[model samples]
Each structure stands twice: as structure tokens, then as C-alpha cells.
Target: MLMAKLMNLVSKMPINPLIGAAGVSAVPMAARVANKVGLESNPHNFLLMHAMGPNVAGVIGSAVAAGVMIKYLG
Candidate 1:
């Protein structure tokens, strides 16, 4: 996803690993919050698994990016 690309760019900066972790954690939390909000108004319309697709993709994207960074940089 675009966020993964943005994170790759951001990684070029001299940020602490903890800060990077916090930033990454926000993705899943935001996705869950969005899903919860969406379900509240129209529970019959959207399934949890459907809402989770983007979240899972983002997680995978971040993981792949991190792997690439570690492999190349270290």
C-alpha cells in the first residue's frame, strides 16, 4: 500500500525504533476503529472479515518493507 512506501521514505530519517513501532501500530488500530464505527451504523451491511482486508494488507506491506530494509541495510 501507499503507506508502506511512505514508511520506506520515512525510514530514511534518523528516528528511533520505538517511534517507528508506534507509527506502525497506529495502522491496525485505525483499521479496527474504522471497522467498529462502520459496523455500528450498519451491522448487516459490512462483515468484520471484509473490513479487515485493508488492515491485513497493511500489516503484510509493512512486514515486507521491514524485511527488505533489514536485509539491505544490515
Candidate 2:
């Protein structure tokens, strides 16, 4: 429980945008590589990409996890 609280607090700490920007910058190159590997040419490929986007599971999982953490924290 202490570990979870510590991690939850740590996750909320503002990270340098350079770190995030660097991560965002790699997605396109990764997609291009996926294209070369024949992973991005299909319509379903976009679905997978969107799954990685803000609309799908990634951010949602964080939001839900944070919500749970906050609820219990308070």
C-alpha cells in the first residue's frame, strides 16, 4: 500500500516535456518501420494504432488507475 501510494504520487509528478516529446517523436518512425514490415498497410493496422492513441486503452488505463488511487487515497 505504501508502495502504491508512492508510485501514484510519482506518476503525477510533472515529467519534462522533452522526455514526452522524445517519446512522441519516435511513434512516427516506429509506424514507418511497421509499414516496411507490412504491419501498417491494412485498415486493421489503424485500429491498433488508435489503440495506442489517447482515445483507446493507454490513457484510459492511467486515468482509471489514478481514479482508483485517488478514491482510496482520500
TM-score of each: 0.48, 0.31
Tens digit per residue, CA lDDT, model 2, 1-74:
35445555779763322122222324455334433444434544433243234223334566788899999997
Model 1, 5-74: lDDT tens digits are: 5666778763222222233335666555655665676786443455456556667888999999999999
How high a TM-score does candidate 1 get?
A: 0.48
Once fitted onto the true fold, the runs of candidate 1 whose alpha carbons sit more than 4 angstroms away are: 1-28, 40-43
Q: List the residue pairs that clash in candidate 1.
A: none
Which model scores highest in TM-score?
Answer: 1
For model 2, what is the alpha-carbon lDDT of residue 35?
Answer: 39
> Whole-model Cα lDDT per candidate?
0.56, 0.43
